[model samples]
Target chain A: MDKQHYVLQAKGVDISVNSAQGRLPLVHDLHLDLKPGKVLGLVGESGSGKTITCMALLQLLNPKTIQIGGSIQLNGRELNGLKPKEMRNVLGKEIGYIMQNPMNAFTPVYTIGSQFVETIRAHTPLTKKQAIELAVSSMAAMDLQEPEKLMRMYPFQLSGGMLQRVMIAISMCLRPSVLIADEPTTALDVTSQMQVLSELDRLRKECGTSILLISHDLGVISALADDVAVMQKGRIVEKAEAFQLFDQPQHPYTKKLLQARPMLPMEYEREKLVI
Target chain B: MNLLEVVGVTHTYGSFRSFRRKEKAATALSDISLSIGEGMCLGLLGTSGAGKSTLGKVILGVEKPTKGTVLFQGQDLYTMGAAARKHFRRDLQVVFQDSFSSVNPRMTAEKIISEPLENYERLSPSELKRNVAQLLEVVGLHADDMTKYPMQFSGGQLQRINIARAIALKPKMIVLDEPVSSLDMVTQTHILTLLNELKAEYGLSYLFITHDIRAAYSVSDALAVMDKGRVVEMVQDKDEIFSSQQPVVKKLVSSILPEHPRNRTLLNGDVFV
Candidate 1:
């Protein structure tokens, strides 16, 4: 594949945290590439630096306590060494982020409309009225009920599922080429999880947005990811096409992970029974 | 006689915003009824806000239902005397989801596990230490781990410690509320295996509450589906979950991500292979 086809590319990425004792490397020589309109599933156990890697891409990590080294290219533009003001332009307009907890993603005190309007005005040349119009349209597109009413509600008033949809809507409103979703559906119930997953699927299909999806659940990754990268202790143990990774995983860890997931009765093991 | 029985149980959360305005009561559980035979694992499956946790709480005596009775060995749990309630507590224990918060951070594994024993029995310190060490061994933790605090252990190990504590009292029934949800897949399997072994060795029953279908099917002898605080369907055989026709249950079953890549049906009707 040509290099220009990849929307986001990271090569030799290393992240380390500094403490009183010394510096401890959290992620080592990680490499990832997200193709345009493709979903890259990053799977790992907790504390395996999956979240940290995504944070590194967004330049969200604290510079004083942590060190990030590597080259990250978004649409052929080098992301490293960009000033805060310049980085702001690339953040929401070119690359969007959806955090795991929707509660923390928005200010509890402000109505959803204000935050959406502010975010739009910051990234685009639209006025507040035009930005609110865009926000309403996007919310309606996500199939959220009463888009205008929802905008007036505080974050606390909405259920978890509703809040997550609103978060996704806000992120997609900017129509970024690349979107990084960190455990987006982990907190949701099965029904709500399906809704969010379908919404994400629609986003990819409709907008052709490339996604870097970070989740521990193999089932979720199987449902959405086009490619898979298994991370263990700050390293990618395996990277392959999604089907290939699940069907014929080369790495022992990947195989172990695949086998570890619980399946339906058709896949049940008699030896697993107690009696 | 059934090991445990819940009949016509209803739980409601009264809104306490202010005395000035009356808020409508939110029904957490509505006329729910179920039974678990002795030494049987009954899986309570539901989505969020489906009252799985509330039902578990009612069974564990953490909350009193607005209506109906929970019976243990044919005796009403709510009407029991103080001494009987104490004995009931000894026979029925619970393990919650978050291990870090469930187990005290400052206490060593020994103290945490030996708490129930200390509360009920008059064992000497050495005997208590011996029991703690034995419990640690049962959960596949090293004997030396008795001195270690919660922070010193991983999420999986801490969960093991919590399991050790739940089994400390030699309970006849244990309520496992999403016990392995916070752990990794590998660790989840290990914990499930350990739970099965402990159940067989101790002849214990379990009220396994979880949203994950795979986890529910792994150890449950029977499964119950709950929606909006009601048990909509009960399957005596675990394999029958696939044939369930209830819309809610069907939605949950279909929501399970395919374990094998070949089983996946893409959006375009093409097989993943």
Candidate 2:
């Protein structure tokens, strides 16, 4: 792939939080690239700064206590230093974000339809009717039954799976060039998780959207990510094509991670049956 | 005889919109029957809303099923008198999903582990301290850690402490509800290995409940797949779990992403659109 095909690029990206004593480095000199229409998996344990690194791309961190450094480019345009208003425009238009918890993503008081309208109107010149139409269509595409009825329901009324699908529909309705999903399926069940993964895969093929998927589950990463980056203690320990990283992991942490996962039944049987 | 037997358990949660309104009941578990043999781990696998946790609660005596009985050594758990109930509680202990919330933050590790011992037995201060230290050591934590609060430890360490507390009373059975789900893979493996060791040492049975098939396979001697408030399939042989023809079971088995690249079939599975 050509270098220019990279939809999103980050070089030496660092994040630090102000502590009582002084500034403490949270993420150190992290580099990442997302090719167009491909998924890049950022895998790590808790407190490994995988979430912070992805948050840095969208300027989501609080500027008062958090400091971000280095270059972040989306489509060869500098994003790290963009003005707040300019960044706002870039947020839902050029790049969209799906948060870890669908419950926290929306206001419980508002109907799903209302939130969809507000989000759509904020990013585009669409009227309420048009935005609702777009949302219903998007929900339909996700195989959600009775989109009209679902739009009238509150966030609390929906299950985790339903809310997650709604979140995905709302995020992708605008067809942003890139989508950043932070543990998108962590709160969901296995069946719903598979559905969400398929939805993401479909979005990539249908819309050619680049994805930056952050997850602790290696299984999840394996299913969706075209490329993988293994992170440990705020540092990128290894980065490689997904297949290569899984097959012949170079780093000790990567190897340990692979070994730590419980073997599936088929894989377990292969060992026992062969012997 | 089975160490623990859940016979035709049915649990329903009731919701009343107003004082005048009639209660609307939602069935959480429907006629779920299973058993755990002595020194064996029974894995109850299910997705969310599948009643696995409800079944766990019923077996632990935290929730009383509207129908049926949970028998411990052939005695009905719900019908036990006060004195017998206390003994039963000591015999059956539980470890929840979130270690941080499960443990009291204000108490030190020493107090947490010794709380159960203090409830049933009379121990001198020195004896109590020694027991706490021994429990900590068994869970692979340092004896010095007995003085530290839960906040001072990592998630994995906290989980180990939780295990220490669970094993402190030398319970006959432990109901571990998604015990390793919140922790990382390394921590999960460590905890699973520790549980296996403790089971061997104490001959303890476990009701291991989780949504992850891989975790279940790692620790369980037998596997039971629950779906929509029902136990759809039970496999005494772990190897036969993959060959399960139940649609829900097949979906779950196929849902597991192939760890090795060479064995990839997740992308080709037709379960997902």
Candidate 3:
């Protein structure tokens, strides 16, 4: 495929952290591509460098301690080595980020409305009234109940599911070209997970927003991902379409991961009666 | 014999009065009742804030119930004398969801596992060390790992340490409150399998509390579904749970996404709940 066709492209991306001993490598040479309106699921265990890759993409990692080497392009424009001020404008406008824990994502002292309106106004030229209107609509689009009441309440007042929805609302309001969700549903229950997934599904379908979904749960990944990439210890071991990857995992690590999933007790095991 | 029985238990929070006015008390659990037979695993399934953990606390005697009776081995737990309660303390133990916070960060694995032994039994240093090593092996960890602190180990390994501490006294019953929820998929299966083996080997009874349907069903011989602090449904036979009539039960069962994309249930927004 031509380079211009991809929405986001990372070529030979490398990440390392500096320590007293020496520079320690965290992620080896990596390559990833996110096309327009495609959901690329990145699956890995904890400490597999999935989050680090996402951070590196947006230049969220501190440059002083962590060195990220590679060429990252968003919409045919180079993103690596961009100045702090330039990167600030690109973040949440060109690329959206949703973290695993929604509770810690917001400032506790500020009301949800204040935070949402502030973030929206920062990227776009709009009045407070206009920003509020956009925030309410975006929140409603995410299917959040009582957007006005939720806006008035503090972050601690909402449930985890509601908070996550609000987070998605804030991230998707600008309609960024790429959305990087790092374990978005890991902290939520099953019902809440389905809600978040459906909202994501709607966003990709209606708006054609490409998503870089990072999660450890295969179930969540399989449900939405058009393509899947299996990462192990900072390297991509396998990349295939969702069905092909889940059905016939090529890498041994991917096979072990699929095998390790908790399944319901077999039919025979459920036959025995307990006292 | 029933290892534990909770009858008409109702737990309320913030019932005490403030300086000027009485606080509005919240009923976390109301008239909740269940029984765990000896050597059987009873899974308590619920979403968050459903009063599942509160019930676990009430059964473990961590909190006093507003109105109820907790019978352990035919003795009323709350009404028992101090001497008897202290004696029974060693027989009942607990493992929490966050293994990191459940243990002291400053202590090594050896000290954490040997805490219950130190409290209940009089043992020399060598004997206590031997018992700690044995417990570590039972949980599928090396004896050398006992010297490491909680931070040095992975999340799954630290949870194993928590399990070792719970089973240290060879407790008759364990209240496992979301023990594997924080870990990843692979580690979850490993921990659940380990819990099952330990249960069969020790003939231990478990009050397995969690929001995860697959984890709960894997080890639970019987399952109870809770919604808003009440036991909405109970599956006496674990197999029949797949076809339960309750909306709450069906919702949980559908939450476990199919392994293959061809069986995807979340194609639209309405199928989930």
Candidate 4:
């Protein structure tokens, strides 16, 4: 069991961001862990600070207006005080992040291969040709159709689902100890969302990557998470096993989320109006 | 005649090159025929790019259908002249999806709601104040909130204001396009309940368009499932909708509307358009 120790752990972690408007503690006393080969879902609405907590895990909190306190351990190494360059070395190889908007992450002007190869070179000391080969094979491993063709194509040429799969493929190829995905499927259509989610699930099974999934969509969480944390207004209101949280949530916010959630087939619609 | 009838409507996108040469054109909505009754809500359910928004725009007279006619109260919508169309606008209103942008940032809530009333005719100074207050109250806002700006309110509150503006005109029918899609799920439930209550009070007919089938099921009395610009299946009752004969409609219905978690994802049953 000791071999299955946490790949990522945050204890009493607090994050605050400063804006011209004001400085605010976006996450308060947040404690979570990502054990190897498991998925932990951080569920909440907008402003609930689920994403902030994830950002704090990677020590990626904004430098201005953002204050991060507490311990963030990645593969038993403290990453809280590391410089940005050192952080980057730890980030992709130790902890991979799949951003919510795959569209904005890529440089629109460059080919997908250029950006991907650049990423590979940044971490691995590979020749230019080797980096391109790695990029092509990694993209192919992502289930992308014709990696060579995609290597020449721009980000806009690929659909959101394709881009997301590529992102996952790149992240997994690095074999990061921990993977954090922020609303990974939030921007896609249901079919596309399912496709990306299934890919993420596939990656977990194949690579045994510990995942921290952050989302406002409960259905997505329900489909992916083994552990669940329900957050509200920058606080974790509840934490439980996924099925337990779904079946018997303790937090008022969690119950409210459940009440507000529209079930499939919508049994409630059959009943008369009730507030 | 149906309270609202759409017969053989078709809309296409893209144009020909060389000013007359035909290029690739995609049919947005095609050969759509449907009838909605008074005081009833019907939802337009579809995935993205299913031409649900286009159908709503066509019904609202914002976009002219390439073919077919929309009969409102047994009268053709496009038959009227421009000035006549302006008059018809008073009876047909829209509550768009993005409530934040739908409202004018420069105007306060009162001005936003009363803009239509102010446009139709010049109300007396005191009467305008009273009318705006009444509109706000009808949509569950306080009388004091008449002075607040749109930014001051939450998304759910803003959506309420959108509804109030639509109902302020007392239009017989409303075209709602993904009204609560941007809002959180719980807020969506409240807004939907409020819409139902308002419909009952005003006897409004709604053409509800949304990608969320569960939302459509909750609020709409009947539903039409669209795929690639065609209404493949429609049912008068929500229960009957799930039992559709068409595989495209059934696949869509089952995939999105299920409450249970299956070992496998919802399948298309080897048939889909």
Scored by TM-score, the top model is 3
Candidate 2: stretches off by over 4 Å: A1-3, A269-275, B15-23, B266-273
Q: Write the per-residue lDDT of candidate 4 for residues A46-142, one digit (tens) a residue.
A: 7678777777777786666578988888878888878888888887887889998889978899998888888888899899999888888888877
DockQ scores for all predicted structures: 0.57, 0.57, 0.59, 0.31
Query: Which regions of candidate 3 deviate over 4 angstroms?
Result: A265-275, B18-23, B268-273
**Candidate 2 docking band:** medium
Docking class of 1: medium
Please give the CA lDDT of all the candidate structures.
Answer: 0.90, 0.89, 0.90, 0.82
- Superposed on the true interface residues, model 2 gives a C-alpha RMSD in angstroms of 2.3
Worst 10 residues of 3 chain B by lDDT: B264-273
Candidate 1 local lDDT, residue B40: 97
In CAPRI terms, where does candidate 4 land? acceptable
**Mind giving the per-residue lDDT tens digits that candidate 1 earns over B1-273?**
999999999999984668778778999999999999999999999998899999998999879898999999888998999999999999999999999999878999999999999999999999999999999999999999999999999999999999999999899999999998877778898899899899899999999999988898888999999999999989999889889999999988888866655455335532233
- Chain B TM-score, structure 3: 0.95
TM-score of each: 0.95, 0.95, 0.96, 0.89
Q: Worst 10-residue stretch by lDDT in candidate 1 chain B? A: B264-273
Residue-level lDDT tens digits of model 2 in A1-275:
67687999999998999999899999999899999888899998877988888889999888889999999999999999778889999888889899988999999999999998888899999888888899999999988999999999999999898899999899889999999999998877777888888889889888999999999888888888889999999999999998889877999999988888888656777757646
